[model samples]
Target: MKLKKGINIIDQHDKFGFYCNGKFGGNFVAETARKPIEDLSKLFEKLRRSKKFLKKRDFYFKHYLGGETPFFKLNNLTKYLGGAQIWCKDVSAINGDAHKAYHATVNALICKESGKKFIAGDTGAGMFGKNLALAAKEMKLSAKIFMGTKDISRQAPNVKFMREAGAEVVPVDSGSKTLVDAVSECMRHYVSNCDTTHLAVGSAIGANIFLKICAWSTSQISRELKRQLIKEFGEIPKLKLINVIGGGSSALGFWNEFIDYDKKHVELIGVEAKYAAPLATNAKVAILHGAAQYCLTDKEGQIAETHSLSAGLDYPGSSPLHGLLKDTKRARYTLASDKEALNAFKLVSKLENLRPSLEPAHAWSECIRIAPKLKKSDVIVVNNCGKGYKDKKIYIENIGYYPE
Candidate 1:
């Protein structure tokens, strides 16, 4: 389990830890930050094994991130489809209107506990950056956010929120200048500054420690979903959960709780942007973001550039957790093009009177596509992981109109 120092971070990425071995992820932490980060992993594992029902995260979810979100049955969408029952896991009410806060807040708390003065991390659509900033502020810790320049422009709303919350937003100009670059720079920055910083990875991704921590924190979603399902129907109904796949945090969180159930009982489906799909495309295994995973690679086997109208989903690879799920056939991955997402965004806005962020709109689009094929007793819950407020500009720009 001994890992050598990660090297040539700005160039060669394979020196980061391999995904399979019991090694530190990314091998990316500095000597100073290593113990603290390792302590964090231990802390999360301890709480996870506690019999207190994960009460700490539960408290944060309610008060800090806006209590247990609703599992509202989409009456209009269901009636419109006329096949399966559709439900919306409304995460829009959470802080930053996304599930990023689920892990960000807890990570900031852990930073404070570790006596760190700052929490540093990266963002894609900017929700994670904003959430990290807000969490640090609430914990009275300094925050630094790294975001790719491309994301800064399209996700201005969250960028503004991050700055307004008193966090320094560093624009990454490297590589594609999008999420992948932001993650690289953030982890690199942590290497030099880990004396007082804990890397706050936003999604269920990155090196093994990061992937485990983020996924563990976001698992709060499915925890709530499981409880809400019983309360809603007085028993768990035939269910299929659909969530957008970026780094696969939210989707993993949404699906993990139900994963133990029989596939014939609670099915899980993950939706990815058509052009950015790694798992959905059944991509070949490769290294990305310091770990082994599936990615869309070019003919030369380098990770391919990905395209998605949703800034959050505009990445070439997903978490190894997803790769395992896909390979095991426990979860299914599918694609939805930008046009289909745009259409679903507008259509659902009109039908449900709910404005969905483009990220989750992809998930909704997949739900819209498959609901018509299921039986009437089947229940479909789509993770509306973000609100549309942050996407108003992008939405209007693409469709020339945003629904009122």
Candidate 2:
């Protein structure tokens, strides 16, 4: 099927790519970067005018970003925490059970339109793989997912979800046996199968074009946060937006809307696992997973091994934008230990009846630690990126059983 004009699926150029330290990294075809609607403002306008586009948009809205996720002040949990008005953006409430659902749906739509019959990619905790697999099923495309053996074990539920969604999950047993290795393997697969397959990267740390696409697609979170805050507070409140940085997609999405605003009024905090705190400790610029960025490495410059209770946070590198943010001080980078994250997980479940996946639990850990030091009137928004159902087994084995 010939695609519409202005949409080039196979072209690769730096037209919409990102630069780091004045060097070009990678690029993506413009067609896949912007899907469904060409212009942001014309989304509703287009939906109103075109029944075909509206049907497609409604498919995504109903199956992916239904906009029903809760965005409200966690009054009970906030009072229990004792300082700051804590608000939670419940991304887990999305269709595929995580924020990755948005990007997965967008990429799948692109693949379907590009006339690709096969889709391939890698995942950290399997959420992206699961979501992508579901999208492939809906679009009648074959999916191949590469996941670290370690992640396969820790995120078994998500692996099962992927398989059930008709995806083939391949385990990578290479260096560190984690997300980075899976990324390498997926890229190799994409290189060999480029004609019939498309690699839908799950993170913001990949090729420059993909980073832009994922960040742009997920930026809806920031847009909604702005609107919700205004409605709840009668104006936008001074907020310290906190998100756990795996490949930095959530942070990039959460901060995209606020980028042009005054930096002092809104603070962005990116929390990484203490076991893999490269952004906070040694954010030296390096290349990994096709993009140049700050990565965790050894003296010999080999990618270093990292450990985290959350498989999603076990990556050894971060997105280039995150590195730039660290250098520019636009966002503060911090670390949360496994103990702290687990404690926050238990606290949120007990106090608010919400079970956050270990990934965003890192952000919750940081918020709990810092909320007391801030003014009572200050607002703190935590990007609760994923639900905790997938972590039940790991949580039971590592942290022991929790009472109902």
Candidate 3:
């Protein structure tokens, strides 16, 4: 538990820490901007008694980056979209069905290693909720899931899985009865249950542990993308832009390591739901619920809202790191509506025979919109977040059926 020179413990008791670069004022808590000693080992030891979560430091790496995920060239998509070239980092097939599994599984491990009794989380019954439940069962830990009534009503498939996985699903009927309300209710629960529960943030927000795990989990795509592009094209082409966002974990998973890259060569885009646009609507930083660091919130204290068909993106704010990226003008932020997201979802299913998670496809939808404006020689990588298995029933129920 001795203090390390370059590593800063972001969460003292959770063994959540990050490496600090000398620049940008070194490492410190985003709220107090205070540095802490490196005592993660002691914290890890204390948490190791749980026997439900992971005690192994390399578990995440072994599980996430250990396998070969598809990184395929989008010959058909590029021609279809009329872009230079399109490629997908196929996170759709990650364990438990979504890229969120990468983060959730690691988080459950962290919760177990931290001696946390139970894992609590909120969801719209999307990949995040399902992944957490799956991970909890895999780790032999109990899980409490807060989801919106509407999400439960709509996302029945995921609800079944959550129940099957032994998760206690609490439905939020308050407020909008949607993703936002579910997250709010979950935060309220976490605040009251903080002593015994470790709120496993679905994405790279909420707690520092998410950022660490996501950075490592999603880095596989970026690393593979670079290698694949090089092998295919004989060189690492200028990464004109990379677009995706969530609690900012998905984007951060790829973008965090490349923070210092040449800004002119690569562009980063963080897409938000049009109804809950934190980066675009609330540029001024504020602390979001359940966190000490600043985030995007409205004057009324709601997370800046966005509108999207994807329940996964119903949050009002981006992670503070995303806020920092936005403030520094290091990333471009955009908004897409539910209509656009649904269109993209259907388009992907029809064209690629791939039904992506609504969230990642939301970002890809923007890429499709912008493709015509780009040069034909350019290349783009889209984070294909999750499979649409959980969403198919809802799609069928709402739209009747897909055309053959």
Clashes per candidate, residues 3 or more apart or on different chains: 0, 0, 17
- Lowest-lDDT window of 10 residues in candidate 1? 3-12
Candidate 2: tens digits of C-alpha lDDT, residues 1-404: 12123422112223445453334245322343334212321332333356785467457856556765678788887888788988899888888888888778877876776677999989989999999999899889999999999899889999999999899999999987888899889878876776678778888867665676677667768878888888889887788999999988888888877765556789999999998888888656667866777888888888888998888999888887777676667788999999999999888887886789999999999999988778888999999999899998877877796535
Cα error of candidate 1 at position 267, Å:
0.9
TM-score of 1: 0.90
- lDDT of candidate 2 at residue 219, scale 0 to 100: 75
lDDT of 3 by residue, 1-404 (tens): 22222321222223233222211111233332121112323454454344543335345545643554677776777888886677787777666676667667766876776677698888764677888898888888999999988788877888888999999999899876877677767767765766677766566554444444455555555665666767877985666555556576677665544555566666777777777676766555554543433345657866544455667777665665565566567677887777777787777677786777667767777878887788877777787767777777656655565543
Q: RMSD for all candidates, in order, please.
A: 5.8, 6.5, 6.0
Using lDDT as the yardstick, the better of models 1 and 2 is 1
Number of clashing pairs, model 3?
A: 17
RMSD of 1: 5.8
Q: Mind giving the per-residue lDDT tens digits that candidate 1 earns over 1-404?
A: 21123321111123343433422135434476566566766766665667563676677778878788877898999999888999998987676688888888878867876778988998999988999999999989999999999999999999999999999999999878899889889988887877767889888777666787787777778888889999999988999999999988898778767776777898889999999899888788777766667888998888788888888998898887777677667788999999999999988998996899999999999999999999999999999999898899988989999877
Error of 3 at 337 (Å): 1.6
Candidate 3 overall lDDT versus native: 0.64
